[model samples]
Target: MPVTTQSWVVTQRLPDLLFAADARDEPISLTAADYRALHWAWSEAIGDYTRRTVTKPGDKLVAFAAIAELFQRTWRAEYLAGLWRPTLLQDLLWATNYEGRAPRPERYRAPSWSWAAVDGHVVASLLDDWLGAGVGTAVQRCEVLECEVVPATPLLPLGKVLSGTLRLRAAMVKATWDPDAQLPVLYAALDRLEEATLTSPPATSPAPELTQIGCAYPDSTEDACEIWAVPVLWNKAEKYAAGLVITPAATEGVYRRVGCFHSPEPDEDPGRLVWMLEQKKQEIIII
Candidate 1:
């Protein structure tokens, strides 16, 4: 059985500036043009983080790598040039209390979040044995569904691109599941994503089996999280919209009938779980 939890991934082509954290002494300055090459001394490296430092090595170097120009145009370009290493820490861990951990991920299981097919590549990096240079800590947090997290793993400093997403999961999950839920930096980044669909790939997907988890908070909340998504349509232009199905409110239609996850959010974690379901919906749109 797939152990469900909150997670997301970013997918994009390999960049030239991406260095190996294992090669701490390698050149860090790189442009999009250098993303892929046959030979580089330290191309494959994994970064590590502990809760002590304000910023880790991977954050420092990867941040520079994300922006090709930062290294090229800064007044201290030559001085900062020496800091380019794959192990650069763009994010550092902060100590916080988390009650439980996300269940160990199952193979080929649906991640708590999804992305365009291309973005899936970056998402897969976390599972790698060497684990790459930038994604470990947050993954560790996700292990416990540490709700207070910033979710920096999926962004990857954007190879200097620094972008966002389309729609994101509303923080309406069960308190039992989302523990310390709060708005995350990744929440805001989703905005850069196009509101409308960009793909029209046909939906030959098999019907997904629905596995309903009872709403953690129902009376004062929006709707419960969906168990799984079924491929009902493939038309990206038609676009998919999810909402709440209200039956009691009829005075002026203050409530939605269904698919109303538009923002202002729900009362609690039940909404958070539903939001994760919507994240899957967004993946369907992009796919």
Candidate 2:
């Protein structure tokens, strides 16, 4: 059995890790290398929890897994690559929060450090600002997102958005394509049940509504629509360079998927994971 180690420094805050780290008030400065380790750890942890469910609007509760996955793919991935830092963060913070506050905006006023009101989604918003940049290859690619997380339109900043209420039963509602036909369009509703209630399935069935989120990718309207679905299903999506996994569902045919992969299997020996992908890219073979 392979021992799952936290390869990401930024993303690796397990339930317990957060508590320990939060003990310190000041930022615990880490080197670039340390940050990458945290990023890998965080990605693995986030993927472990949020990979299972799909959520829709008016369904009850939003799919936190979807949001968590977005965060890891966004800032955590780039931070791991060592591409973003104080400079990148500075730019993002300025554009998103301090843009119009001209002429020593600091003197006049400023937005709260915590932009969120109800949900403590500061982590999510920070990830968005840092990761959401560029065009072409820079576009984010992941499944479940069916839309993109647009930064500008919301009334409150991302750091301070809410899912209405926490009292509502948590779950993903079903999605129907043709209402009369009652065709199942797949809304993979998995509840993040409480530890005490895992023994039983949800009491009320899911009744999801159709609403679009801006950050996720839109469904393909091309001849190769099914081909696009492949990228969404691939478990390890962030591994791809285009932020997309190029594959298609086939009955019994082999396909060549376009992608850049990191090392799938590391040496048994304990070593750094930063170069693991680059050094072991060729060693990884796609079935």
Per-prediction count of colliding residue pairs?
48, 24
Q: Candidate 1 residues 1-287, lDDT tens each?
A: 11111110110232323323225554455443342231121122111111123133233323323333322322123111212222111111111112221221222111112111011111111112212223333221111111121223444332212222112222222111121232111121122222344576434544433322222111112232321222211112212212221222233312211111212223321223232334433211100
Each prediction's Cα lDDT score? 0.22, 0.24
Q: 102-208, model 2: which lDDT tens digit per residue? A: 12111101111111111111111223321333222433323221111222224322212221110111111221121112111222122334445667756775554
TM-score, one value per model:
0.19, 0.25
What count of clashes does model 2 give? Answer: 24
Among these predictions, the greatest TM-score belongs to 2
For candidate 1, the TM-score is 0.19
Candidate 2 overall lDDT versus native: 0.24
Instruction: In model 2, state the lDDT of residue 80.
Output: 13
Question: Against the hidden true structure, what lDDT does model 1 obtain?
Answer: 0.22
**Residue runs of model 2 more than 4 Å from their true location after superposition:** 1-17, 55-62, 65-149, 152-287
